[model samples]
Target: MTVLALEPQPLAFRVRPQADECFDSWIDRVAAAHETTRPALFRHLGLEAAIASLDLARGTCGLSNEQYFAVYQVIGQLAWAVEIEVQQIEGTFLNVEASVVLPRRQRRYVCPLCWQQALRDGRAPIIRKEWILRMSWRCQVHALPLCALPVADGAMSEQAVGSWLSGAVARAESLRWKLGAHPRLVEWNAEGVDTLVRASRKRFKGEKKAYVDRFQANLFHFAHDRIAMLALAHSRVGKATWGFERLVALELPGRPGREVMTLQPPKLPPRRWRISKGSLRPGSHDAGVLDLVLAYAHLRVRRDA
Candidate 1:
């Protein structure tokens, strides 16, 4: 099947009243970009959870809504990487540079139900408006949101990038704190630490300590294990295959944006392995690293099968 053929209906909507309310506005913009059926519910659940957590966090840090949203924007921008699928058609794939299809005017482009109906009918949905005209300067396909958009000269500095990265890392760390540490996380480490921490914190408000503790521990182990598996798996892509046991013993970094070369916990038993370059998966590691891990895991599974 063509890449487009396999693509699901995207959730789409424009953020309403783009002026003051940063968090609400982001929810709108993200929802617009998302275009799936029941877009509001998805937007609400994800955005609301993030907002609620921010409120709690602010109790300790004294964050303003704007500040919280600013951090949220950073998280939104860096937390998911995007992958562009360029497929060869009758000949080779086009080598054209991709650009933002800016929107001509502020308007609602797609009704969620209508788009779903079209997808259900097996018709390929065309983004009818010119891409750049339809999108905001804030929107970028392959790069992270908010920060990835083009800026005036020297507008986005290395220091700014560093700040964004640091914030992202801190958020991930918070999530990890809630979940508790695990060998699995150590195994395929990515930036999901913050997400895990949040999950754990959200648990057990009304449950028994024994059950809550057990569940939280289980979640920690699961989260850590899956992330670790992904890290170890990614490390082998384009590289030689090692036995599954060998994979477990492998040490990889557990943060997003961390290069594979930087994950030096210690040496493992000597075993043949392959190293692949330029095969990172976008949006996998809350930035890009975890995506590599997932891609590697897929390759391993195929080889083993």
Candidate 2:
């Protein structure tokens, strides 16, 4: 007897993407809602073949032109399977030249308070798009530095991710009580940096267009160069465990203005910073280093404005 292949169909219980949710986060939530693993859900949507075409190692943040096409193809199928428009799915993807400004694994940082609040509100915790950006070390809503969890090099089951987040949130709450406040893991103005990032995404027209373009280009160049320099200095120090606080304390050459660097770097022992697994492109640095670089970039844009 011959068996027929089933056509992909819309899920009966679809989970809509939350505001500013990451694509992967949405996928995980959908899978959980359907009581299936992410891989199984992909298989149901006939996405296994498309997944093979994608360079998952490059992550979802910085896709090459070809990779972008491949990702969009996959997103199209997923949108169809979930009964949503392709544009809605695309909105979850990073729409910036973020390869150099995001961690290799992406989605490793989560705001504990945000996660807890989501649970309290009877909503599934989501990995916000902003949290994936290296420039976003602190949560704007909570005004707290986002907590970093161990990087999962590849895909994780929704159940596993949920468990990991619960543990992370518990730890954060414990730490907060012990410290009597959120530990100043890194000193940087999250609102300023976030505003700069948002402004970069805006499109100006006609006369103002050329000026905006030049401004964005200069900001990107400034950020790229400073990130490279900071990564180099970090490498020369011969300590992978050096936290941002320690690195800043060294008064590394070409440090930004005093206004941004006002706080004396805390004399904390070097904490082991885990490098997310992947082959990063030249000049693309780790998230920890990128945080400082973006902070400096924010100062540059403000001064030049």
Candidate 3:
């Protein structure tokens, strides 16, 4: 007896994934636009058990190269058919340091005006990559700060981006289990939230390395005046993790700002000057530490200039 091979079926409706649009968002839209459940779609593509437990949510793609291959090889072109780019999915995992894996948490934020426009244009809302920057909170186009939305009960900011506000959360628990994850990853919060936390530079051999180490060591004792003075000597620029969205805002080349040196402490540390961890990219601990270091460099430049 001979068996017949089933041909792959095209989706009932096609909606191209928006550029830099998230994985979860793409899948949700594709399923909804076709009036189908995700399971039915997966079964149609012979991927019912492949991504069986893969929750298509933001920051769900913090994958190692091996994991990427394992999942993609199994799912094959079905993932691509939905416009999922294999290379850029890890854009959501914020800190790549081997030493610390902060606790898993959910955060939600959205540019209200941008969403309104997306609705008018019949496009799904997106959690653009720039929104993940520790230093970026305000939408340049809207000129209003990204507003926080409730994670559980509020409306989805865009597509499924409503579930991922900080742009820094880990992907799904099931994905981490299936993938070949590195041994060092863990969720932690050092000290009583204001104690010294350290991480060795994964890459080395530069003046920036020296400065980075120096700043990290003194994270608990900051001097605003001294930091402001050190902001000038080195011009180590930090670029946005992602590029601009079309019809959103003009992408400007941003560098370390001299004004960041003047940042005021939210509250006097209890004899411990550890950084505050916030949802905004600029307000994140990494930015706080770097701001002081950059200021320190600026200080030396001013003293001799």
Computed on alpha carbons, the lDDT of every model, listed in order, comes to 0.31, 0.53, 0.39
In model 1, the worst 10-residue window by lDDT is: 86-95
Candidate 2 local lDDT, 1-305, one digit each (tens): 99998888888886888887877778777877787777788788777655644434223556668777766677788878878887777667655664423544445567877876887798877888776654454467865546666666555565776787677665444333222221221222343244444535544466345323322222222233332332222231212222333433345557566544554332435445332334433322345454454345334333333
Q: What is the descending lDDT order?
A: 2, 3, 1
What would the TM-score be for candidate 3 when compared with the true structure?
0.40
RMSD of each: 21.4, 13.4, 17.4
For each candidate in turn, the TM-score is: 0.19, 0.53, 0.40
- Sort by TM-score, best first: 2, 3, 1
Which candidate has the top score in TM-score? 2
- How much is 196 displaced in model 2, in angstroms? 6.8
Pick by TM-score: 1 or 3, better one: 3
Q: How close to the true structure is residue 276 of candidate 1, measured as C-alpha lDDT?
A: 36
Please tell me which model should have the higher lDDT, number 2 or number 3. Answer: 2
